[model samples]
Target: MNVEKFKKDHNEILALVAELRTITQAGIAKNADAIAQQIRTMSSVIKLHLAAEDRVLYPALAKSQNPAVAKVGERFQQEMGGIAAAYMEFAGKWTIGSKVSSNPEGFKEEANNLFKALHERIQKENQELYPLADQI
Candidate 1:
């Protein structure tokens, strides 16, 4: 397996998160089309990434007997579900365009929480779980 590919994906996700922060901040300042585009791009990227992990990575990791590995896989699945739901909610609000930007504070808050949780989970998987899986 190409661990570098996983690392690259991780970096891409971080970059997207950074873009999201900027977009949300801009939205809070005023209604910005760029924010809407960023949200759309983020939604697409996140869904693709999660699908790839679910199809290619998680199943492999779940095959392991190690309790730590199994636990990580379970946690990842749970987090992915939460992320998917949050993405849907964000998309719905964002589709409302100006209305979403008008009250960007709440949207930004939720986005921040989701981003932080995802970051932590990704970091744990990359630093700990992935390495162990590679050994298998």
Candidate 2:
């Protein structure tokens, strides 16, 4: 069974999120070495995804010349700032081992919160942004 590339990529990204959540929940002493590395890798993948979405979709939608679409595009950009800030905070903090590994439970809670926010952002992009892009 050959999965579509985007679908495969999306699934892998979600899986990585879950894996990080699991690792953090397992206690950092046992997984300390791996946590930062995994988060770094995930951050890179996420940036790529976001950049691609920005390149192909956001600009396209914004420049659509349709009043409704342009409005949506503007709102989308504004809304994304919150999501982006949250992600950046998570990514930057987790890159420092001491911050993430210092208190495993605390780290897990923060990670889960960020992951939940990311999941909602992705769902919004897929549901509203992607379709808006397609509409144009």
Query: Whole-model lDDT for model 2 versus the true structure?
Result: 0.74
Clashes of each: 0, 0
lDDT per residue (tens digit) for residues 1-136 in model 2: 1213334456678989888878776877578668988889998887776676567656777788688987887898888778878888888887867766677677777887888887887677667665666667
Model 2 — which ten-residue stretch has the worst lDDT?
1-10
Clashing pairs in 2: none
Q: Model 1 lDDT vs. the true structure? A: 0.74
- Expressed as tens digits, the lDDT of each residue in 3-121 for candidate 1 is 66677778887898797677666545465567777778877777777778788778877787787877787777777787678768867677555756677677677767777877887
TM-score of 2: 0.83
10 residues in a row with least lDDT, candidate 1 = 24-33
Sum up the clashes in candidate 1.
Answer: 0
Model 1 misses residue 70 by how many Å?
3.5
The per-model lDDT (C-alpha) reads 0.74, 0.74
